[model samples]
Target chain A: MKIGMMSFAHMHAYSYADSLMKLGNIELVGVFDDDLERGKKVAEKYLTKHFSDQENFLRTEMDAVIICSENTRHKEMVLNAAEAKKHILCEKPIATTIEDAEEMIEACKVNGVILQIAFPVRFSSPIAQLKNLIDNGELGDIVAFRTTNRGQNPGGWFIDKNLSGGGAVLDHTVHMVDIMRWYLGKEITHVDAMVASYFHDIDIDDAGILTLEFENGVIATHDASWSRFAEYPTWGDVTIEVIGTKQTIKVDAYKEHIRMFTSGAKSLSNVFYGNDMDFGLIQDFVECVQKGKEPSITGFDGLKALEVALAAYESSEKNKSINL
Target chain B: MRKIVYKKLEKIDFATTTAKVTIVKSADQLTEGIETFLVDEVNFDSVINDTDKVYIPSTLLNVVNENLYVYYELEQYPFFKKIKEVIVNPKGVLRFRRTGIITENQRLIASDLVVFSAILGEPLTIQVKRTTPAVTPYHTIVTVNFGNGTMAHLEYTFSNDDEKIELEWSGIKQIIEFNSAEMNPFSLKNYTSLPLAYSVDSILATARKADQNVLNRLEEFTSLLSGGVTK
Candidate 1:
């Protein structure tokens, strides 16, 4: 199978490229980036072709393409990929707007191509185990979920609203929301949120706390913030506390780590040694496309998560809980 | 220099179980041996039956001081220094809620007494109504209010099947940690490792220094515990 990367706007594109290279019987057709310099640099680093033109990159004999463009650029890229008859594994927050997301999903459907969202946390071992335990009724009935997905603010394009859509609420909320939606097998019915820019002097929000109610009567609270300082052990973390009637299970995605306290560093740093979630996600996408099977995480899953995040922004703006 | 020897009783009927004495010049040695001799050697059942009123021990107060000392030396972490209050809920029920600066040598007496009281197997001071018997499922929440618009939440949940503890410190810098699970009580192989923010050697050296300070504050801590000091 031949897979080409659409853009290197997001950092994960490099990791996904590494995943593609490691897999057997798959060829990394090369990369395409709107920024010619970045495209050339990444292509040179990977020792592959750099297609400066989008049309030429899409016309290349590739079976699938992974889209890691900016949030706002996702729609255009997905539409282009669909028209080119290429299967897509797009990055999360599928698009800046719900309408854009719906259009992307429709375009993929009309083109009869698989559109998988990069929800890599689903591939984490601890998360998979937690889901299994919940499915086995080990936690009786999940009454509520408290989740956090926080990262240090990645400046530049991320802070630019025109490029990245929104701020921490948009960038961070969807991953946990997607996981909860998958775990409960329910849609969020309502959202109440408070977003603030308390941490940074930037124009966009850096912190958000959202409360969501699922159709299955499960209430969840999510803290999506770029609150970690530079000295933090890792870049960020995703933690979920599943509170049930019988028992509670807490899942920390980056828990598999060794804490090292060196003399030079100001604070202790955690060295994580966990399975590469991106590798697992890429492998699944490849296998699904190979077997003509539906993606484990569909584009609609992306749309559902995006809807909740958008609602969170709306709730914060109106200072009232928004019904979904 | 002073030597304080603590004896544990084997049976409630007996006056003492066995007596051991260790001579030390400072409070550091007192703390080092207190855990071994006072906590480990005592027969839990005997201690429960023999004491009618739970008295907060001066040695236990030293432990809290030692903790504060270490925290102070370790960059004066805001979570430790800014703690304005602590609410401990053992067995998933509200037990004691004391409001004051915990790091202050003067304000820790009441809080220290509460911990010492719980360790003695006395029923926790019930501040709120509980639906279930405050037993069986063991869970404790040590919430430390920073008074600076922030707080640290330390929680421990233990059941017959499993045991887990979590600590979350947010604001400025955030740390969310879930401690390792404890499966069997009898198995010496099971151990929960504390995540150290500093190197073990540095911490040990700092601990030695902090122990001396803890000892220096011992008199004041004990005086507060004895209710001899008004403030």
Candidate 2:
């Protein structure tokens, strides 16, 4: 199978490209970025061809393409990929708005192509085990969920509201929301949120706390903030505490790491050597495309998570709970 | 002759106090037990003053003591031998709605003393507060930077009756958590359940020595209280 990359705006593009190259029976055709210079640099570093034109890149006879462009550009790229009949695995929040997400999904449906959203946390081993326990009723009925997804702000484009849709609320909330929706098999109905710019002097909010109510009567609270200091062990973490009627389960997605304290370094760091979530995601996408099966995580899943995050912003602005 | 003397002393007016201590492996279960003890066993009437209360609100000494013991054990391993620093970050909510006239600063000092004594080996660094006006239920999260990259990520909530204490030693490969009612005592179970009956004589001797250390600190804290209290 041949797979092309759409852009390198998001940092995960490099990891995705690396995973694609390492997979068996799959060829990473090349990469295309709107900024020709940036595209050339990434292509050179990965030893792959760089396509300056979107059309030329789409016409490269690839089965699918991974979209890692700016948040605002996802809609156009998805539409173009759908037009070319190429399957897509787009980076998260699907698109900046609900309308665009719906349009992208409709376009994929009309073109008879698959559109998968990148949610690597679902592929994590610890999360998979927790899901199994939840599915088997080991936790009884989940009463509530408390989660935190905090990371340092990736300064440039992420902080620009026009380029990235929102701040920590948009960038961090979707990952945990997707996992919660999947694990609980429920959709969020209402969101009460508080968003602020506490850490940095960015135009967009750098911190947010959201209280979400789901259709299944499960209420959840999420702290999605860019609150980690410069000397933090890792970039960030996704920790979820599932409280149930019978038992409770807490999962730290990045716990499978070794701690390393060095004299040269300012703070102790964690060296993770766990299962490669990105590789797992790419493998599933490849197999699904090859076997004509639906992806475990679909575009609609992305749309659901995006809806909650968007609602959080609206709720924050109005200072009232927003019903979905 | 000793039994007759003890019986005679029992007739005198002596202060009596009750304490319920539970050592659990998981800090998550700490609250349920604590709450139950507070409701059923603790004599609120007997607590004539804040100083008389054995378990101060938000000090989280139990959680820190638990982590410190684990850190000491983990240090024995070759992996943690080279560690030189530690950090403790304790963030939690303190529900002060029911307790009239308590302030966030008082609760913070109580909580800070526990952490300071456990990780820093003393409460000398904690500053006393005066005029602690009542604070509404709020979240208290403080990060302790024990210089040299040893840090603790302590996150807790002392508001609304929901309690959670999570302590992570960044320098050491250990995480001690006490949330809600789930208490997996982890390594503390052994020390808590040591064979007191078989080694009663030796244990008593050691307890006497430890008691002196406690009394000395009590004296120091009492003296500091004069200057520490808010006017």
Judged by DockQ, which candidate is best?
1
Q: lDDT by residue for model 2 over A232-258, one digit each (tens)?
A: 778778988776655667898999999
- CA deviation > 4 Å runs, candidate 1: B1-167, B173-231
Worst 10 residues of 2 chain B by lDDT: B1-10
Q: What does candidate 2's lDDT look like per residue over B100-169, in tens digits?
A: 1223433333433433445344321222212111322222222222222222222223334322333322
Instruction: Note the DockQ of each predicted structure.
Output: 0.07, 0.04
True contacts kept of each: 0.11, 0.00
lDDT of 1 by residue, A1-324 (tens): 999998999999999998988896888888999799999999988788999899999999989999999889999999999999999999987998989999999999999999999999999999999999989999876666778898889888899999999999999999999999888888999787766675678999887777677877666667788877788778889989786657778899999999888887657888899889999999999999999899999999999999988898897677666889
lDDT of each: 0.64, 0.62
lDDT for model 2 comes to 0.62
| Model 2 C-alpha RMSD to native | 13.2
